[model samples]
Target chain A: MKETSLQNGLVERYIREVGRRLPQKQRDDVETELRSLILDALEARGDAVVDETPEEAQVAVLKELGAPEEVAGRYAAAPRYVIGPRLYDAYVRVVGIVLGAVALALVISTVINLFQTQPEGISILVTVGEFILQYISAAASALGFTTIIFVVLERTLSEEDLKDLKDETEWDPRTLPHVEDHDRIQPVGMVVNICLTILAIVLFNLFVDRLGIVFMQTEEGWRTIPMLSETALKTYLPLWNISWVMALALNIAVLQQRRWSTATRILELGVKVFTIYVLARMLAGPVPWLPFSSWAGDGMQIVESLLTQVFRWAMVFGIIGTVVEIGQSIYRMIRQR
Target chain B: MDEIINNLILELRRGTLMLSVLSQLRERQYGYSLKERLAEQGMDIDQGTLYPLLRRLEKQGLLSSEWDVSEARPRRYYVLSASGQEVLAAMITEWQQLVKVMEHLLPQA
Candidate 1:
């Protein structure tokens, strides 16, 4: 509340009520404007506040001005909701899933602990209760953090960032993602998926030799083993690098498509088939993976034997993975109809 | 029926209220004086609505405001921005077209 000799107590209270609802930065200015407006009216009434004030006149003025909340409501830039109304449903879903996961983990841990420790039932119950409290607080903290993030984004978003939100605005067809619909292409989710794919490529290309069993480690350095054969890598390096680049381009195309159409699905299927083709060729002869020389000193037979086993497992896994993925792709195409 | 008409009438006036406030602020006037100026021109603007509308216009870069404590009872005076003059001119032309169109559409007295 802000006022001078011109503004009366009643108007000050009204301004205070209205000021509390306004943004912190605008509150003082809003209060000042409200006080000045009301005072001007009161001054017109001739010593209504500073002198013997007429209750009827003050009541009439306040009545005409309307309720403080109603007045304050007009000044609000956006309505307040739990994490704001636009993101409310998504927030609820995320919170519900997290809480559900916590509950499931709690149940599993309780069951496992009871069987393993064979603890007293009362103590177990007490521990479970404590765990439940902790879970509830964790879920609440997660919700609070999500709400803060969304609120900040809601307030700070530029006109361009809000382009996706406009009902009538036309999105650039070229920049569309591989997923269709607002839910399917959930902007953040699609970006994250693309980022993860890039990360996988980087990790594999950079750390190709240091991917398997660690042996003889004591702070300084360990003899790190390679799972994939360097010879195989050298053989496939050209094709592998080309395929990686092509796959990255496909992912980029999907991002541009913005929706999973037949084009994206076909592209994905082609990439999968290409991968399976490479793997099948590798399986026919030698898989790049074998036990290192350090692991088996001149044990060529041991290396060959282990390599066969690794090759068999890869074939099985590869076939199953491809079949499932191709099946999913076909299913998605059919379902689109 | 009367309530519905009243609500509709309020909606009709709401758009003009900003224009009315802007027009009055062409000359520097504090909150009350601005209201009084509008009232003189036959628009009984609400203080709550007028003050917020002034602030909103200021935010939109249409009106500029300053606080003056020179006299008893410090007051914030508002004046139209340079951009506001340009917008007001365009809006006046648009408003005239709207009035002409409405007059044609509306049932004759």
Candidate 2:
């Protein structure tokens, strides 16, 4: 039977509308499927059946099935992982590396702290050093726990039947809708990071001043002062903290972009590691000045001991923070992929 | 009596529509031929509905289709994909069990 212009127009329009929503790889497949359905309906009604025009019948069938948009949506309703599988696998591998590094740092620092001693029978430096080591240990344990939970949830809760559906839905780079400038959330994330970093710095300074006398009585004495020095503070404190703030901002930007890339995700991770390193150096007293040698007189030995222990603990915290941050970044990157 | 019998038949077939479609698709058939065959078997499905269902099943990886353009008129022929075959095998096992249960429950013929 000769196809009428009206019937042809209806089929063409329907196919085009539906096809536009589908990925190019699957577009032809969907069109063929849709065409067969229309033809099948016409054939079932019979070639000689003349109650309704082909155009009218086609339109009626399309209407009952709903709009092309709605029909397309049903076929495309497959679940999307926030982090693609490849990224998730990468994240797990990277996090494992981070956790291992942190654990090693913790063990090494703990052993070193055990051997180090103070002049006075009970030195506050050792106490502080022990406290920081404990803190790192605790933080690492918490992160390890959380990662395990999330991984378990990902494996157990994910739908097994929808595996193919997940694979079929390709991440089309072109069709990824452009994010509007105003909709960007990076600025907000950076602002929050800066605010938090500032708060942390202020707290660190206050803690140092409160414990200044004790630090001075230790073997390393003036070395602990760099942790509170405004210049060293500015140099070391903000590096990774700023990077963290920026990483968070970039993550927000990525979210706004609506398309995930491994490059942006890795950059975000790099910033997180840099931030942790900066914080570690700040806590350990920036190396160039040899801040430990300046303290003098009768209390030099005590001050030296105190500063040494404090620096050691700071190193421990820094090491732990670096690992945790790396783990977090790797997890997020993999999850996003 | 005829109306009641028809409605019961529909309900019975409705539950087994997917299985019926899979069973028939052991041999390759296009959308039009599939609908005709089903109609001949007394399950008269609307073309609009069957086609979409077939597409959905194909998308789900239960069926696969390819166009046969060697003939003057090109037709899209669908058959059970590997995954579809596996699912069908499982479904048949369940169906046999169901049939045995029904046979035991029904009054002696």
Clashes (N, CA, C under 3 Å) per candidate: 18, 22
Q: How does candidate 2 score on lDDT?
A: 0.66
Candidate 1 chain A least-lDDT 10 residues: A1-10
Best by TM-score: 1
After superposing candidate 2, which stretches have Cα over 4 Å from the reference? A4-8, A43-48, A64-66, A80-337, B1-15, B44-49, B52-62, B81-83, B102-109
Chain A vs. true chain A, TM-score per candidate? 0.37, 0.30
The per-residue C-alpha lDDT of model 1 at residue A87 equals: 60
Best by DockQ: 1
Candidate 1 residue spans exceeding 4 A from truth: A1-8, A47-52, A76-149, A164-337
Per-residue CA lDDT of model 2 for A84-156, tens digit only, reads 4634765576667766666667667655655564322244345556656775776578567757765555555
Tens digit of per-residue lDDT, candidate 1, span B1-109: 9999999989989989877877777789988887778888899888768777777788889988788999876789889999999899888899999999999999999
DockQ in order = 0.50, 0.16
User: What TM-score would you give candidate 2 relative to the actual structure?
Assistant: 0.37
Looking at model 1, residue B45 earns an lDDT score of 80
Error of 2 at A65 (Å): 4.6
